[model samples]
Target: MNSERILILIKPDGVNLGHIGEVITRIELKGYEIESLKVTHATKDQLHKHYANLVDKPFYPDIESYMTEGPIVAIIATGTKIVNVFHRMAGDTDPSKAAFGTIRGDLGREWSDGLLRNVVHSSDSVESAEKEIKIWFPEK
Candidate 1:
């Protein structure tokens, strides 16, 4: 089928706050195909590797803590232009100023100190999507 593929990581907070189904529903409603999915606790090593890009950022430690706090649901969705489309639906990383109707804007909370605490993560580009897919689903 020639569908562009993308990855979605429903964060710890999202899963803990009971938004997994809602988030999945929104994605499916947008017409993406669920290629592979799983819900599991993230290991410290996986967290470190998955977020290696942010390792030098100041907020890296906090992000690492939050991600490892609980279990996350990882998913691989496929569709035409799924990467770009998913990012649009996910909204800005910081949800406060995100436009309405986006997942983050609708379900996210304001950050008082520094963390965005957005509901999910979507790959930023095709290369990133491919790399991320392997990180999250190496067996695929």
Candidate 2:
């Protein structure tokens, strides 16, 4: 099988809630190798660039604000079909709706009056991974 490289972002809320270590451990246990990792605050320009595709989204501003609310950890992990595998590990985007054993399922919270506040982020596909990797790790 061809190996896949994905960009994973542990959002500020997740970091503040102390889910980063557990999330990384889960990723490692899933047999993914950490190609790169860093903990830094994402500037507005960075977030704007990262979520450029979502600019047309009605929730774009909120996403941008939330992303830059605090420090975030960005990780690049590689493994066979890692992108897909990681999504499964993340469960649904909404923690309340996520299945058990999934990261979101285990560590999700309510936002905007009980809306989804799932922790962690995994690239949805290889193409997306490539695009996101560039946004966060342009040097690579």
Model 2 misplaced stretches (Cα beyond 4 Å): 112-116
**lDDT minimum window of 10 residues, candidate 2:** 109-118
Candidate 1, overall lDDT?
0.86
Give per-model TM-scores: 0.92, 0.92
Question: How do the residues 30-97 of candidate 1 rate in per-residue lDDT, one tens digit apiece?
Answer: 88889999998877777778788888888888888778778899999999888988999999888887
TM-score of decoy 2? 0.92
lDDT of 2 at 116: 38
Models, CA RMSD each? 1.6, 1.5
Q: What's the lDDT for residue 101 in model 1?
A: 93
Q: Which candidate number maximizes lDDT?
A: 2
